[model samples]
Target: MSLYSALYSGVSGLTAYSSALSAISDNITNVNTVGYKGTSTEFSTLVTESQTFARYSAGGVRAIPRTLVSRQGLLQSSSSPTDLSIDGAGFFVVRNSPSATAEGAVQFTRAGSFRPDAEGYLRNTSGNYLLGFPLQVDGSVTNTGNVTDLVPIRITELTGTAEATENIRIRANLQSSDPLIPSVVAGTYDVTNAANNVATGGVVPNFSRDIEVFDAQGGTHTLSVSFVKTATPNRWAVEVYAKPASDITTGAGLTAGQISRGTIAFNSDGSLDVANTTPALLDPLNIAWTNGASSSQISLNLGSDSNVDGLTQFDSVSTVISTSVDGAVFGNVTGVSIDRSGVVTTLFDNGLTRDVFKLPVATFQNPDGLTRLQGNAYGVSDFSGRYALVDAGTGGGGTISPSTLEASTVDLAAEFTNLITTQRAFSASTKVITTVDEILAELNQVI
Candidate 1:
């Protein structure tokens, strides 16, 4: 009976050590695998009955394999723009299907070696697509924590629509010492009048600047702002012309491809005095296009009425400090990149950038409790609890490191050490079986 027990114990030891060897082998094999987590074999004892003074019992061993999923892997620099890694806790959300609306199972992974397919869908080597929340034009996430709201990040479009110019902000200094233009009657100021031209025996403007504006069809047109000093102190007639005053000979009212005039009055301290000037002149000026393009309403922002945040009449040479207009021509998407906050920005050929999507990282209450799936991915289990999907670098989610990858967590030296110990234990267990068999054979011969 003792020999039979000894044989069973040796078999159990062999089985347990074999399982341990298998775990070690797996760890060593995946040393070069990206984002691979190692596994370890845990042993448990089996007992038949409680020990008593008159009786003795032997116990066998059982092996239980456990995955080291919570350990962090080293981050290595990568050349791809989409390659990403997490320095802290969290996993990149992914899906098996390529369709954005496909009702496929969601998975999580640490492998970040990603490349875009022909459809511009980012997928890893395992063929799982990266999932994220859609972004509005203002760079805000559409959905916060809902998993179902996540969609595949696709950038199939090659170009972005052109936008019309709406607002033009100009900051400049109008020389206060410049001579005033000869003033006619206040109501007789006509931009088309030949007398308005300073080049041909007419009143000369002290300063002028040219700006290009885009229409609804992205047609470019020149807008010229001329400042004429008036008889009133600290007041100047601001005239905007599409063509030079010398080119208009009809002396007719302003027409298409002509000019519009407004008046600006400044305070003694060089601040804008909107109360005394016509509000129509300070409002948005509509420009009619001769090229059949839609008329554009351009807001001329010189400065605030009571503040000197824009145009200033200083006692210096007239100079344009800065000018900015909000409009863009039709452009093709030239490239894409991700930031630390996981915003995927698409760069266009027209020097315009857009935030297309916000990549959200998913974290679990107990990451180690997750069930390991194929291709270095994990699935949610009952013990793992629910996943909390949050934007990257927010709500405890780790910041995404673009152009990097997570290396395997397996240590080759440690795995080799474990492999040697497991092999010795397996050999010792076989010896126990062999010795027990010899004793049993001798006892049978005597009988």
Candidate 2:
């Protein structure tokens, strides 16, 4: 009985050493793999108790494979902006399929070598799609750390974008010595009358400038700004109307092609007097587009309160200075970039950028207990605590490093040493089996 038990124990020893050698080989092979964690085999003794006091039974050894998943690796820089790596602690939440939203299918990974696929979805080498929360047009996201809110990051859908004009700043000078319109009042004029309206070409403006304003649909519209000095001293009647009167329809309290009609009051010293101006500069120009676009409230920056800037009243000839409008034409997608906070911004050829999405980091209590899956990903296991999705660098999550990747944590020297030790252990186990065989043969001959 003792001999049989000894023989079985030797076989078990051989199996344990074999598993160790296999683990060492795997560690050595993945030394250069990106975000690869090394595995090592640990041995524990298995004992069998004998029924009789004098007899003893030997049990085999068992090998337990442990992964060093929480170990940090060296960060290497890359040229691509999509490459990312965790600097502190945490993994990127991902999914195998772009449309997969099941909580059980969610995965966490340290590998960040991601690139846009044919459909403009960002995925890693193993086809794992990156997940994030999409931002609204107002730059707001209603993310409450819920996993269901995550969606595959797709950048190509943002084909062409147009920015609506938010504000218009005019810095031209108005001639103070100009005579007022003889037929029209200084501050009040009929917008519907053909003989006095600015949109219908009824009254030629003393000083007229064309300004281009962009709509939400990226359509550009020209606005004709006219200034007619009134009989009132230092007061001018201003009317801003859209060109090609069919571009827009009049809203309440306005006429056709009328965007805004106001009166500007200037001090005797050529400075703007905001207290006397009708339709105060604080009010924005309300415009309702005929095309399918949201209504716009255009802010006006005419001039300063005291300085001779913006819409200035000077005795010299009215000179048209530079006018700046805040809006962009239709801009095509040029590229995308990510920041340390995991905010993905889309770049446009028209020099416009928009915040599109934000990546979330998942942290666990015991990362090593995570189940290692194919393609170097990890799934939540019973041993691993529940994951908490958080913003990058917040709530113990790791900060993202753009244009960088984490190298494998396996050490070549250590793996080589372990390989040699495992090899010797296997040889000794084989020797034990051969020695047992010889002893058994002698016992058989005696019997």
- Each candidate's number of clashing pairs is 0, 1
Off-target runs (Cα >4 Å) in candidate 1 are 50-57, 100-103, 144-146, 180-189, 192-204, 243-254, 258-260, 269-271, 287-296, 305-309
Misplaced by over 4 Å in model 2 are 1-10, 46-61, 101-104, 144-146, 175-193, 196-206, 228-233, 250-256, 280-282, 292-294, 307-309, 314-321, 436-447
Model 2 pairs whose backbones collide = 186-230
| Candidate 1 lDDT tens digits, 96-125 | 886645556899999998888988888999
Per-model RMSD to reference: 4.1, 4.0
1-447, model 2: which lDDT tens digit per residue? 887888888899899988888888888888888888999799999898888989888797878999989999999999999998999889998899877646338889999999999999999887899999999988888667777789998888799788999999888888988776645644445555655677677776778899999998888999888887777788887888889778888766666787777788988888888888875445898888898888888998887787677888998898788899988889999889999999999999988899999999999999999999988899999999999988899999989999999999888998888888888888887887899899989988996
Error of 1 at 370 (Å): 1.7
Please report, in order, the local distance difference test score of every candidate based on alpha carbons: 0.81, 0.86
lDDT of 2: 0.86
Best by TM-score: 1
**Model 2 / residue 126 / CA error / Å:** 1.2
